[model samples]
Structures are given as structure tokens and as C-alpha cells.
Target: MAKMRDRRVAPSSERRKNPFAAATATRADKTGDSASDRKLVTSFVLLCIVVIPAVSVLLYYVKNAPRASHTISLAHQRGLIKTDVTYQEILTVISENASQLHRHYTYPVLAYITPWNSKGYEMAKRFNTKFTHLSPVWYDLKSQGTSLVLEGRHNADMGWISELRMTGESLVLPRVVLEAFPRELLRNKKLRDKAIDLILTECKEMEYDGIVLESWSRWAAYGILHDPDMRKMALEFIKQLGYALHSVTSVRNNKQHLQLVYVIGPPYSEKLQVHDFGPQDLQSVGDAVDGFSLMTYDFSGPNNPGPNAPLQWIRLTLQLLLGSPSSRVQSVGWKIFVGINFYGNDFILSEGEGEGRAITGREYLNLLEKHRPEFQWEKNSGEHFFLYSDDNHAKHAVFYPSLMSVSMRLEEARSWGTGISIWEIGQGLDYFFDLL
Candidate 1:
């Protein structure tokens, strides 16, 4: 029994002390670890070879996927796929883009308001908030002896000023063409200096924001084009007026400097004799003044029976005003405010006598309402018109710019990054307000 117990204890002690056995065990552990490491490296290599290529193909397919296919897939997923886009869908997209544009874009809108017409005063009151500047046609200047004299009477009940003031709109005085005015007065340095003094004094006293110089008298324009001296005097007058006006601050806002706006007729070809207004005048005036109110309308008036402002003509005019290599209208740093006609022209179709008669937008609408005639839209000119026979058996054709045409012009102005100035406020149709 003692020998058997010793033999069991001896085997346990020998196992614990056996160096060869320990070495063999350590060797086996090392062999297992090497196999595991080899398996892990092999798995990594297989993943790189297979998964990397698969991921690269998927990424390429995603990046180069067809837009229509992707859209269709998204629509199908939402169960909203359709065969075609409807008109309403297109309109919705357009309206959304317009709304975004409205939110982002902002510029000045100047409206002319005549004080003589009660309707105009009312319209100015009604639309004060829509306008940034309200220019009242209440002032005119004439050469009296050696000094410039104010010729127009101011309205005693000038409530429009208060109304505009309440809406934070500016009041600019409109200087109309001095009737029967002699061009020689412009050449007189003393007279020009007196005129500048008078204008600045009145503006300061009335607390006016600025003045709109309606200096584009046909005779004056003709003289400027024909006579070099007249052109020089005119340029000098603009420079002096601009310098004087800009030097003074308005009493209304002590920090605000006076603004000078020069109104010029539509730009015409340099080669054309008797152009509406000379391009040289525009370039020079643009240098002196803050802006130029390009009178783009009156292309068709009592004398001419056509679209008031043909879109193509307007495009050419704008291009010229902006300047080109061969064009006479060169760069003269200034902002442009395009004029939009709120009136229309009516022509008597019989005998072509008394052909072109000016009519307001409201008048045009009233005639349409009474006649109920078939109206047609001229696509080329962007004008709406109708031919009708009066009770006297005389035929008449009326051409006018509807809101659609106005909108197109406005879009053009916006595209050119220019402001818009309605010819007159009261003459526009009621629906025209909605466009603004």
C-alpha cells in the first residue's frame, strides 16, 4: 500500500518538474497561435479583394445614377409617380421661384403723382406704401429777367405729403419743362447760378428729398444735338446743379444728402439726325447725377400709332444705354430707372385722320367694358388691342399695354438690375396695383 501511494505522488511531482514536457506544451501553443494569425490575415486579404471591389462598383453606380431614374425611384417609393408634368405643376414651380426671388431681391420703385388731378392724389395716397419715392408734379421753373422763377402753384391742401411721410416715402419735386424757355438762358452763367441757388433754397425750405430734372425738352434736346455750345452749356448746368444739390443736406434728415435724377428720352442710334435725346447728353448727365430716368415710353403717342414701347426696341435701348464698343452711349457711372407707360394709344381706322389719341389705362379698360369687342394680343410687340366700330360707323383700333405686358417689361427691368418708374400713378388700371 505504501509503495502504491509513493508511485502516484512520484508521477505528480515528475510531471510538475518535467522540462521536456513543458517545452513540448509551449511549442504546441506557439503552433496554434501561428495558425490563428495566418487565418486572420487570409480573412483580411479576402475581405480587401472581394468587399473593396463590390463597394467601389456600388459607389460608382450611385454617383453616376441618372437623375430621372433617381427621381422616378423616389416617386415610386412614395407612390406619387406620374406620366407627365402638368401645366399647374409648372406654374407651381414658377410661383415658388418667384416667391423666393421676391424674398431675396429688393430695389427702389419711384412713382410720379400729379397734384392737379384729384384722382392722382387719391391714387398716391392709396399706393404710398408701394412706392419708395413719390415725385409730385407741382413745380416748374422759368427764366424771369436775369433770375429763375417758380411758375407752378402749390396745392393748399397738400395732404399727400403727410400721407407719404407716414409711410416713410420720400417727396421729390418734379421740375417740368420751362415753356417758351430760351436756350440762351442756359448759356448765361449768372442765370444758371441763380437757378441752382433758387432750386437748392426751395428744396431746403420745403425739406424736399431731391428733384427730378425733366430737362429733356424736344427743342433743348435738338439744340444739344445740333449746337456744340448748347451741349456744353447743358453739361455745365447739370454739373453745377448736381454739385450744388449734393452739397446740401435735407432738413428732414440731417444725415441725408440730396439726390439728383435726370430724365432723358429713350436712347437712339448715334447716326440718326434729330434723335430723341443725344447719347452724349446722357453720358455727361449720368456722370453728374445719381441716376437717369430713361423715358422709354412715348415711342408711340399722338403722333405715332404703334406699341408704346416695343420690347425689342426697349432691349436695344437698354443695350445702348449700358454701352457697347461702337455705341455713342458710353459708361458714365449711374443707376438707371426705366419708365413704364401707364397709358395707351387709340387710332381711328377711318381715313387715318386723328389717328393717335392718348388714353389712360383706366380709359382703355372702360372702352373694352363698353364695347365688349374681340381683343387680340400682338405677340411680337407684347401689346393688347381690339378693333371696333363706333356708333358713328367709324372704325377704331386701340393698342395698349395690359398687366401682362407691364409684367414682361418689369421682368426685363429686373433682369437689367434697374429700378422701375411708372409714367403716372392715377392713370393705371385698378388691377395694375396687384402687379406691384
Candidate 2:
């Protein structure tokens, strides 16, 4: 009895010492105010959750708010317009753009390729899809008949020098490659021979869809445009070029026809108009070659904000081409590729600086279709008519289209039996392959 009492006394003493020895009997309610504490803990956790994310998003929006809503690449940024294009990849893009075009026009467009700054051949080799490329092998405007490549300063942003068509002096080039050609090579007879050798070698190895002589207007026009001797020499060179292309195509036993294309112009002294070029100018160029590629852009005065070679002017020119006795030659020869803008028509300025839209080719569609839904192209006014504010901005883009607009460009192409060439290769015209 004494031992049992001692054991019980020991257990009780241990319990008292531990202060929490009633473990089996004790519960959460005994230890604390359970309901109120739980409520307080839940409220604290919920407040933490609500405040943290709201603060994060608020900070993010604040940081991005200062950025201009519509700024693309900044002005100082290089507008090189390059892609890390593989040969196969670029061909794919060509096929893609071609296919999208097919949906709009049942007749697949005669996809005419334009030469890139220095990347022509590399671009040509990528595709087996046969199209047109305007080769630089023909008489270069810079060196005239003396050299294949142009050698002069790149054209000013205004493109004013070509407007002037310097009489006795050298004209400036609008590309770095031509501007940087070796002077010694051009001056020395032996070097000139070697230069021709190098150029022909590359051009022969990789054939273009066609060849375009630089400023054919300057070269083809006798006396009125340039010295008769220079004009005669240039024409002789063009004849040789035409014959040579005929031989190469003949040798391949590929009856692939060549289009000898050229960019023509009226001098800077004269006002630029479609009527500026008459039947005689077209006739002279047609006699030299297969087609006329009107660089139908840059017709506007220097720094004009109007559309680059507006459709009004374009329609006038096209109508002339379509109507002329040169129309026979014009039908096949009329390769009218209206130059689309990679840059703006001119700057929208802020205090004499370009503080305007860096409108891209795709963005033009927005003006015609999205921004001003009701705008139409007026023929008599010879421009896209729209309402504008006194602030000198094009407020509503109302475009004019009779038969000459994009609405009928390809349709008319089919009707008139001519080619419609755009000044580019890549865009999002891939539905043809994808629909498969």
C-alpha cells in the first residue's frame, strides 16, 4: 500500500513539474481562445494576398506608362530591313506571299523579284521557283556605259540629284556598294577589264529573271537627255546585253523569256507628271529592250507628305502606257511596279525635324480600310481625298479608285494582259500552302 501511494505521488509530482502533463485530457480550447485567434489569423493572411499582387501590377503599369503608345524602332536605329534569311527559308516566304496573292486573284501573280542592296545573288540561289529579278549588269547610271556598277554617293533622303540629272558631272548613287566601288579599278583600263570579268562571271553563274538598265531614260535619250555619243554608246551596250541574255537562255534550251526592264524619268527641272513621258520616250526604251519598269515613286517634290507616287498619278501613267502605240510593246513591256514605301512619303515634322509616322507598307492598308472606312480615291483631284484638320495632318484617309485602284490592279492586269509588280518579296501571303 505504501509503494502504490509512492508511485501515485511520483506521477502527480512529475505532472505538476511539467505543467502540461495532462496531455491526453487537455485540448486546443483549453490552451487558448481558439475561434477568435483563427479568425484573426485568416484575416491577416487574406490581407497579405490582396495587397501584394495589386501593388505589383500597379508598379508595372506605371513603369510602362511613360513609353509612347505608338513608337516603333526609334529614328537613330538602323533601318536595314534585314532578316537572318536562309536560302530555303526565303524561298518559303516567296512561295508564301505568292500563295496569298493567289486567293485574291485567281491568276497567280507573275512574282517579279527586285535586287537587294548587295544581296541579289544570294537571294536568287535560294529558290527554284522561277520569277523575275532585275539584274544590275546593264548600263549603270553612275558610270554610264563604262562600268556595270554605279559609283557615286548614295542618294540624299530627298532624292533631288536624280531630279536634276547632272549634265556634265557625275550623278550620286543611292547605295553603298556602288558608292564604294574601287576608283582605281574604274580608272585603269586593265582594272576595268578585270572588273567586267568579275561582274559577268557572277551574273552568268546566277541568272536573274530579267535585267534592268539603270536610268534608261538618261541612257536611251539621245542629245535631249545626254550627249549623242554617250547615248549611242549606251544603246550599243544595251543591244549587246539583250543579245547575250538571248544566247544564255537559248543555250539552256530553256525558252525562258527575258524582260529587259529600266527606270525612266523626266528631269528635275520639269514638273513630274504622267504626261511628262510621251510616246517617243517609251519607244526609245522599247527599241532597246523588252519592258519599261517605271520607278513610279519619288515623283513628288522633295519632302512632300502626299503618297509616294499616288494612285492618281499612277493611273495617268498606266492609262498612257495602255493607250500608246507603244502599247503593243507596252502590253508585254508595261511592267508597272508601283514603288511601295519602306519609309514615309515624307516626314511629318515637329519643329523642322521628322516627328511623324514611320509608316510601313502594311500600315498603308490601315489608312485605306481601318482608320477611315468611307474614304475613296478621287480621279479628278488626282489623289486620295479625305478630311484633314488645319494642323496639316491627314485626318481621314479617303482613297479614290476607279478601275486603276488595287481593287482592280490584278483584274485589270488580266484584262489588259500586263504584269503588276510590287517592290518587294516577303509578306504574309502563305494561305496557298497552308490550305493543303
Error of 2 at 90 (Å): 26
How much is the lDDT of residue 392 in candidate 2?
Answer: 49
Which parts of model 1 are misplaced by more than 4 Å?
Answer: 1-105, 179-182, 218-224, 268-280, 324-334
Per-residue lDDT tens digits of candidate 1, residues 133-191?
66767676776765678755464244557666776555555544443254756767777
TM-score of predicted model 1? 0.70
Question: Tens-digit lDDT track for model 2 on 166-215?
Answer: 22111111111222133333335554454334434433443333444443
Separately for all candidates shown, the number of backbone clashes (residues 3 or more apart, or on different chains) is: 0, 9
Off by over 4 Å in 2: 1-199, 207-210, 217-224, 250-253, 257-259, 266-278, 285-288, 319-358, 362-404, 411-416, 425-436
lDDT at position 383, candidate 1 = 58
lDDT for 309 (candidate 2): 41
Model 2 lDDT, residue 19, Cα: 22
